[model samples]
Target: MTKLYCLPHAGGTPAGYRTWIKALAPEIEVVPLQHPRPSDDEPLSLQEAAESVVEQCETDEDFAFFGHSLGAVIAFEAVRALSGPPRRLFVCGSAVPPVEASRGRDLRSLPDREFLQEVARLGGLPPEIHADAELRQEFLPGLRADYTLAETYEYHEGPPIPCPVSAFRGLSDGHVDKDGLRRWGEFTTADVTAREVPGDHFPLRTSATFLHRAIRKDLAA
Candidate 1:
């Protein structure tokens, strides 16, 4: 059976991909990866998170990576650092490498009020989490850390990997468009395909079954 490593979005845990284990079983084994929270003095960075994933991975196995949003960028960086590249890469609901902030403002630097506004526009985040002050306080730090990692990333130029890239986007996601999706082609020497899945920014949640079916098709191909 093939191994499929699933990475979650920022402020997300490995549990987010728990359903995938059973869904893609028999033919594929799903391994969900999560980032460790750093100490207060040690801020998070893209490289740190990626390196952590690389350490946790079983590099000897035949594996592929599936990541959403911030997880996509982390997966990409990890792939670049890996001694053996994955058989395939699935990047969902994210822009091409060297991801920029939604607007000119740095999301990590924005005030809580303004930063959340930008986040709300992106969707995926539950509204109730923001409505409750205690929850907001608990969640914002990790969310900001994720934003910092993504927003501060600088893509170093390198040869495209040999594996195929299957870029999945949400039909209603305003952040990424067809052009952004197509741009993923530049990072792969092998075939790169763009697919429009259901829902807005969080298709993995809104259309789990459909997304898994699509992934199964790609894996089969």
Candidate 2:
């Protein structure tokens, strides 16, 4: 049986995928990488985080990769750095080709109010969190730190990946444009399929059944 290595989005934790894991085929082992927050006692650079996942991946069995947003880019690079290739790659709600301009910047440098507003606009956080000043105050720092890590990542042109790649996008995702998603095809020598689900950027949270079915069908193929 192949292992499924799951990666979380910016400011997201392994717990976010618990429901989705239950819906997946039981034969597949699910491992969600828990990346540490920059201020959470132990901080890891993106490269360090990726290397850790590579080291922890089940080496004896076939493995597949799935990621969303910032995790998507991390998963992609991690596979490339692996000793060998994964069975397949699935990415959701992220721009392909990676964003070069945002690399190396500290997102915490932005005004807290402006940053939270942007987060709300991106549809990642619940409106009720922002509505509660106390909750917002508690969560915004971690969110900003995650953004800083994501925004600071740099992408270097390298050989196109050889494995099959599948991309998932949301029809209502304001954060990713269609052309940006379509460009994912350029990274793979094998088949690359782009699919659109009916939700915002957080389709896994809003439409888990639809997303799971799509993933099951793709992995089966």
Candidate 3:
């Protein structure tokens, strides 16, 4: 059986990918990375986070990567960090090569109310949760760390990996555009395929069945 390692978006949990396993082909096993919450009481650099994900992979098997948002960046970096090639790489709901954001906005440093307001503006957050003080307090610190990790990532250009690159973006996603999404081709010598799914920034959760079929075709090809 081939393992498909799935990475989650910011503030995301394993439950998102766990849902996909039911839709995935039985031969393709789904392995969701264990993302650290901010409350883990330990801070990890972006590279360390990638390494943590890599350290968990089982050896002696064919495997591939499927990451969304922050997970996408980690999976991409982790693949480059490894000695062997994965069967394929699929980055969903993120820029292909990943563009850099402006330095020093520091969303993580804002006060709880202000920081959450910023998170809300980005979408993916529900209004009801925003209104709940207890829930907001619990979700804020961890989510802020995720946003900081992603925003602070410095993308250093190196030789592309040895597997095919398939990028899946959200048609309505405001975070990334098609040209940026298509740039993933430049990272790999293998043929790259870029296409849009139906939602924004989280199609992996919203469109798991569609993604399962798409992943199945990619693996079969």
On lDDT, the candidate that comes out on top is: 1
- Candidate 2 local lDDT, 93-143, one digit each (tens): 988745623434454677888777767876867666868999988877767
The ten-residue window of minimal lDDT in model 2 covers 97-106
Error of 3 at 50 (Å): 0.4
Q: Give the TM-score of candidate 1.
A: 0.91
Ordered list by TM-score, greatest first: 1, 3, 2
The per-model lDDT (C-alpha) reads: 0.82, 0.77, 0.78
Model 3 weakest lDDT span, ten residues long: 96-105
Tens-place lDDT per residue, model 1, 105-199, is 47667899788777877684666776897987887887887777777667777888778889988899987897899989988888888989778
> Looking at candidate 2, what is the lDDT of residue 135?
90
Alpha-carbon error at 102 in model 1, in Å?
A: 9.4
| TM-score, every prediction | 0.91, 0.88, 0.90
Which candidate model has the greater TM-score, 1 or 3?
Answer: 1
lDDT score for residue 50 of model 3: 81
The lDDT of model 2 is: 0.77
Tens digits of per-residue lDDT for model 3 on 71-122? 8888888888888888999998777534733334577778877888887888
Error of 2 at 196 (Å): 0.3
**3, model 1: CA deviation in Å?**
1.4
